[model samples]
Target chain A: MCDSCGCDLASNNHSHDTDSRIIEVHQSLLAANDAMAARNKAHFEAMGAVAINMISSPGSGKTTLLEKTIERLKKKIRIGVIEGDIETDRDAQRIRAKGVPVIQLTTGGACHLDAAQVHKGIHLLEKEPGGARLDLLFIENVGNLVCPATFDLGEHQRVVLVSVPEGPDKPAKYPKAFISSQIFLITKTDLLPYFDFPVTEARREALHLNPRLQVMALSATSGEGFEAWISYLEGLTGKTRKDNFPPLLSQS
Target chain B: MHEMSLVQALLTQLTSLAAEHDKKKVITVTLTIGPLSGVVIDSFQFGFDILSAESNLTKGARLIITSPTVSYHCVRCGSIQTAAMRPDHCPECSETLLIAEGGDAIILNQVEME
Candidate 1:
């Protein structure tokens, strides 16, 4: 037997048949998506925008959080949104009502938004009024925890959110989402009294999955524990509380 | 499942490989799916079984899949352990916060054609 190619034919007497051969091609299946994601990252940087990808299950208050965030930061920062959904432009419509440049990407039944879809969404968003230049871009991924965590959309940061009603076991049940995300936001905290969710246990589980995860719990409705989230956004945009308002006393 | 999408990608890759090498049929395709790749092996195989039948080039193609073990490093003791699933705690230090490394790739290793 031929030892080189592990063929049944003898090495010295085997015919040089190109018909049969083994090709060694070691490459990642997600390489194409990753390359496009890199290009999307460069495009975002070129526009001087910090893009964030938000992942969560449906009804996790992702849209509500964004609405409140835009209300708070629109005066100081230019915000845009790319909303992904399996069907329906409702989320985009809601974001548009906030007076920001927002585009809706209907995935056509796909569970997750890949980098290519986000690239198209970026171009469409740029065509909208006040979209050409922005300080931040929020890509609201299709509301599914398992699939979105597998695809990179060229975002600067990834945030995985779970609502108090969704329970604290999300991190344990969906390990990939928690493991890949940099931030874990527990939304709808005002329902704590009505729900049995334990914030500490949720944070601890998420931290166990990813030690570097920044976990924060907030209620957009009650405005509870929201200051930290706003400050974190300001930090990402390289702005401070003073930047949004005049200094109390001038240094000069 | 996204495994169907990945299977479609694999079929595309196989079609191109056949054209590039002037082969008539694909005999075997080998893949290495890591424990943390977020891909279900059974789903991927089911996808392959259904999709590969649509084309003559990849029909009856044998798929060989191997999953690599993930390595977890103890945060307290710095000891490393490899397992197919996440270990409950560090064997050396009883620490529960072990950091995982690698084992998150879906790689197309090799293809045999005739």
Candidate 2:
């Protein structure tokens, strides 16, 4: 009998046979991606920038929120964006029109943007006019809630968004997205009056999944509850509103 | 499906392992897919069944998958409970806030090659 695998063999010298053997190996399938993500994190830190990955479903207002955020903070802080999409550079174009460095990564068909894709985006972005220096870098993930949650893009913060029209059951249905995120944004608050979405229920469901998640509701259109969002970004970048005080009264 | 991509990754790993061991064929591959890994078990199986047939080394290889339970820690009572599915509340304190830990890994455990 073969002692290694308990296989019935007439020859006791099967050890040297080398025809069959059981190899004990334990490793995560995502090890390669994780190693790349670690390198990307180091790269982001070396560039003196903080990276944030945004995950949400289609039409959840990720780009609109980013546009508003850039319009609000671009003057105070240097901002860059890496947009991921299945096709078309439309998102990248929109970000570029805001007078900031931006790169678009089209997965071609992949549902999620992996670390390798973001690594390429970072290199291309650095070559842009203002991309070399940035206070904040936002990687807008391919509009997906499921597969995107499994890939780590080396972002300092992971934010998941759900618009009012998407209903309040998103957090409950997409537990993985909520579980892995640091912040949960309820976007499109202006539509709350028209939709059946309940903000409190969504917040509670997300909090139940991840207690450490910082929940906020905002509308990029009406600017409702936008202060908190701005403050959060300012807090991360260690920048404050410079326009708050008049230039004559500002401290040199 | 993303499962197809994962299956390709597995096949690549298996090919390298076979080459390292000087083995020509893989007999069995054992893996652990956690419940919270966000991978559909059936989709993964379907992907493996299709992709493995395209490779000589992994063709007709048996895939054994084991799903492990996740541990949910209660915020109120500090009690911990382990279950394959997410518990609605803490077993001891009935606390609704339970933080899940672990059970999000997809690991290749072992392989039998010939």
**Taking the tens digit of each residue's C-alpha lDDT, what string does model 1 give over B1-114?**
888878987898889989998998999999999878889999999999999999999999999999999999888999999998888889998998988898989999999999
B89, model 2: CA deviation in Å?
Answer: 1.5
Candidate 2 stretches with Cα past 4 Å from truth are A1-17, A243-252
Tens digits of per-residue lDDT for model 2, A1-252: 766666788665655555889888898888778889999999999888999999999999999899888887887799999999999999999999989999999999999999999999999999999898899999999998899999898999999999999999999899999999999999999998899998999999999889989999998888888888988999999987665622221211
Cα lDDT of all candidates, in order?
0.91, 0.90
TM-score between candidate 2 chain A and the true chain A: 0.90
Query: For residues B1-114, what per-residue lDDT tens digits would candidate 2 score against the true structure?
Result: 777778877888888889899999999999999988889989999999999999799989999999998999999999999998888889898889999999999999999999
Please give each candidate's TM-score: 0.92, 0.93
Question: Which candidate achieves the best TM-score against the true structure?
Answer: 2
Model 1 chain B: ten consecutive residues of lowest lDDT: B1-10
